[model samples]
Target: MRIRIGGEVHHGDAVDLRGVDADATAVRETLDLAADDPLATVSATPPALSVALAAAARERGHDHPNDAEIERLRAALATTEPPDSSDPAVDLATARRRAAEAGSDVARLRERVATLRGRLRERRGGDAEPGTSAGEAESLAEVESAFEAATRALTEAETERVAARQALSRATERARRARDASERERSRRDALANRRREARAALARELWDEFWTAFDAVAADAPATDHVGDDPTAFDGDPVAGHAAAVRLARRDDPVVVSAPLFDDEAAATVRDRLRAPVVLVSAP
Candidate 1:
C-alpha cells in the first residue's frame, strides 16, 4: 500500500520506517489502522498483558455477543430488583384468621341476645303489660340495653370482616402483577444472553473458515518449519512466520502498521514476500 504522511509519499509492500521520529501515531495519521493485536506482538510487552489481550479481543469484535444489550440488561437487572410477596401473603393469612375470629364472636353475641329475649318473654306471661311493675320494667330495660349493645357489636365485627377480605383481595392482586413483571424481566435478560452466545459462536465459525481459506492461499509462499508442517495450527503458533501469515489473512488492499525493533531485517524481508497485504514498520523516537 502507498501512504502520504506530512508531504512524504511512502510506498512498499512492507516498508520499514527507519528514522528517529517515525511513530505509530504518525503512521495512523497517514493510514487507517485497526486496533493493535498484542498476541502477535513480541516487543516491549505492556505491564497489563491480560487486560491488553482482552481489549484486543474486543477490538476484533467476536468475544462479546451483543455487548451493548448485555450491558444494558445487566444494568437494569442490578437496579430493578424482583418484588417478593412473602410479607403480603403472610398479612393476608393473618387477616383471614382475625376475620374468622370476629365472625365467631358475632355468632356468640347473637346467641346471647336470643337467650335474653326468651327470658324477657317468660317474665311477661299472661297478656299483662310487659314491664308494669318497677322491678319488671327495670329488668326489661336492662334486656333492651343488652340487645342494642349486642347488635352494635355484631355490626362492627361484620364490617371488620368485610374490610379484611377486601384488603386481602387487593394485596393478592398486587402480588400477581408483581410476579408477572418479574417474569418478563427475566425473560428479556435470558433472550439477550442466548442471542449473544449464538452470535459469538457464529463469528468464531466465520473466522475459522476465513483463516483456513487464507492459509491455503498463502501456504506456497510460507516456508515450512520442521515442527510446523502441513498442520495449520503449528503455522499459526510461529511468532515471526505467524505474524506474516496474519498479514496475509488481513485485507489485501489496506496497509497495517507495526512498531519497528520487533522484526529482524532478514526475517521481515522474507515475511514480506509471504504476505498478501502491505505493512509499515514505524520506529519510536
Candidate 2:
C-alpha cells in the first residue's frame, strides 16, 4: 500500500501496515519514549511505525482526501447548483463588441474630419496664388464662397469627430468596468468553490475523528513530551523553518513528516545535516 505523508509518498514497508493490529497501549508507550529519544524507541514495528507515520503525516498537512476524489466532489457540487448569477461572460463580450464598434466609428469620423480639413487647406492655398485679374473678380467671389462652405463643412466634421471620440471613451470605460466586475465575480466564485472542496475533503478524510481518538488513547496513560513547543511552528505559517525541522525529525525516525518543495542543494545539505534518507517532495500534477 502507498502512504502519502505530507506531500511525500512512501512505499513498501516504509509505510505499509495493512492488517497489522495496533496495540494502543504499546503505541502510546513507544510514542512517549520516541518523544524523548527518537532513535532509541522508533523501531520497525508495524503498529508503532504506523502511529509515527500517521502523526508525521498530520503534522505536514498531508492527511487530506485524495485529489481525484476532491475534484470529483467539486464537479458534482458544481452540477447540483445553479450559478449564483447569470454568467457575466456574455455581458462582457457584448460590452467589448460595443467598445470596438465605437472605436471604429471614432476612427471613421476622424478620417472624414482630416479629409475636410485637407480640402479647406487646398482651396485656401489656391486662393493665395496671385493669378486673379479684375475681369475674374466674379470668379474670385465664387471661389471665396466655396472656401467658406468648405470651412463650415470642416468645422462640422471636426465637431462630429470630437463627439465620436467622447462616445468611444464612454464605451471604453463601460467595457473596463464590465471586465473588472466579471473578474471580481469569478474570483469570489472560485474562492467559494475552494472552501466547499476543502469541507468535502475534510468530511471524507475524517482525519480529525481518527486523530482525536488516537490522541485520547495515547494521552490516557502517557506523559506528554516537551519536545514540541507550546506553539509549534505551523507548516502554513512558517514553511521554511517548519519543513526544515520536520525533515530533521523524520530523518531521525521521529513521529513527524513534512510536505514541501525541494530546497536548493546548499540549503538541503544544511538542513539534512548529511543524512542519507532523501527528502521526498511531491507536487500537484
Candidate 3:
C-alpha cells in the first residue's frame, strides 16, 4: 500500500507478515531499503520498520496493491506457521490521534486544577484575616495570584512554540522559492548565451560574404599586370564604388585589423582630392 510519510511517498509491504515469522533476508532487505531513504527512520520499533519498508516499496515504484504477492513474500520470510494474532504492529495513525487527545486532556486538566486550587485558596481567609492591610497579602489572594502567574507562563511558552514553528515554516517556503527562482535564472542565462553565440556566428558569416563580394568586383574590373601600369584609381564622384575599393584594399593586407577602414564624412573630400589609391581613415584603438 502507498502512504504519504513526512510529505513524501512511501509503499507498504507486499506480503502479509502480520502473523508470520519473518526471515533474516526479508528483514535485511527492508533495512537496506530504509537505509537508502533519507527520510526513513531506522529505530528498533516494528511499526517504524514497517513504515520504512513501505517507503522503500514506494521508492521502487510499486503502484498496484497485491495481497497475494504480500502473502508469497510472507511465506519466504517465515520459518514456521503464522501466529493467529491481529496486533502485529502499532498503527501510526492511532498513535498520533491518541497523543493529540492526551495532550488536550492534559491541558484541560491543568486549567481545571488551577481553577479549583484558586477557589480553595479564596475560601481560606476569614473576614479579618491575618497578614497586612485589606489591600495587601492575604493567603487566599496570594494563592490565586500564583496560579494566574503559572497559567500565564504556560500560555506564553505555548504561544512562543507556535510562533517559532510558523516562522520556521515560512523560512523553509521562502528558501524553496529562492532555490526555484535561481534555477530558472540559470536556465534563462544559458539560453541567452546560446542566442548570443548564434548571433555572433551569423555576423561572422555576413562579414565573410561582404569581403568576398568586394574582392570579386575589384578583380573583375581591374587589370592583372603591374600595379602602376594598370591603374585602379577613381577620378569621379562614386562614393559607393570608392567604399568598395577601400574595402578591397583593406582585404589585401594579411592582418585585416591593421588595414580595415573607418567611415568618415571627411573621407569623401579626401578621396575626391587624392584619386591615386583607396585611402583608409581609421583611428587606432
Provide the TM-score for each candidate, comma-separated: 0.44, 0.30, 0.30
- Candidate 1 segments exceeding 4 Å error: 1-57, 62-86, 123-137, 204-285
Q: What is the lDDT for 242 in model 2?
A: 26
- lDDT for 41 in candidate 2 is 26
Tens digit of per-residue lDDT, candidate 1, span 98-213: 76787787788778878877876776562285537877767777877887787788788778778777776776776677768778787978977776555444443444434545
**lDDT of all predictions, in order shown?**
0.56, 0.41, 0.38
Clashes of 2: 1
lDDT of 3 by residue, 1-285 (tens): 342322444343221222233332343343343334322211112122122223323333433334345444444434433432432123333444455555565576578657857675555544356644655446557666667766766676566556555555555555565556556655655655554344333332333323334434533343332222111221232323323333342322111111112222334334323222222222222
- Point out where model 3 deviates above 4 Å: 1-144, 212-285
**Could you arrange the candidates by lDDT from highest to lowest?**
1, 2, 3
Residue-by-residue lDDT tens digits, candidate 2, 1-285 = 244443545553122222233332333343353443322222222122223333444444554544455466556545653433644455555555655665565566566656656665655566666976665666556656665665666566666656655665665666676667656656656766675445434432333323333333322323343332222221122223322332333344333211222222233223234222332221211
**Steric clash pairs (candidate 1):** none
lDDT of 2 at 241: 31
Q: TM-score: which candidate is best?
A: 1
1 against 3, candidate with superior TM-score: 1
Query: lDDT at 219 for candidate 3?
Result: 34
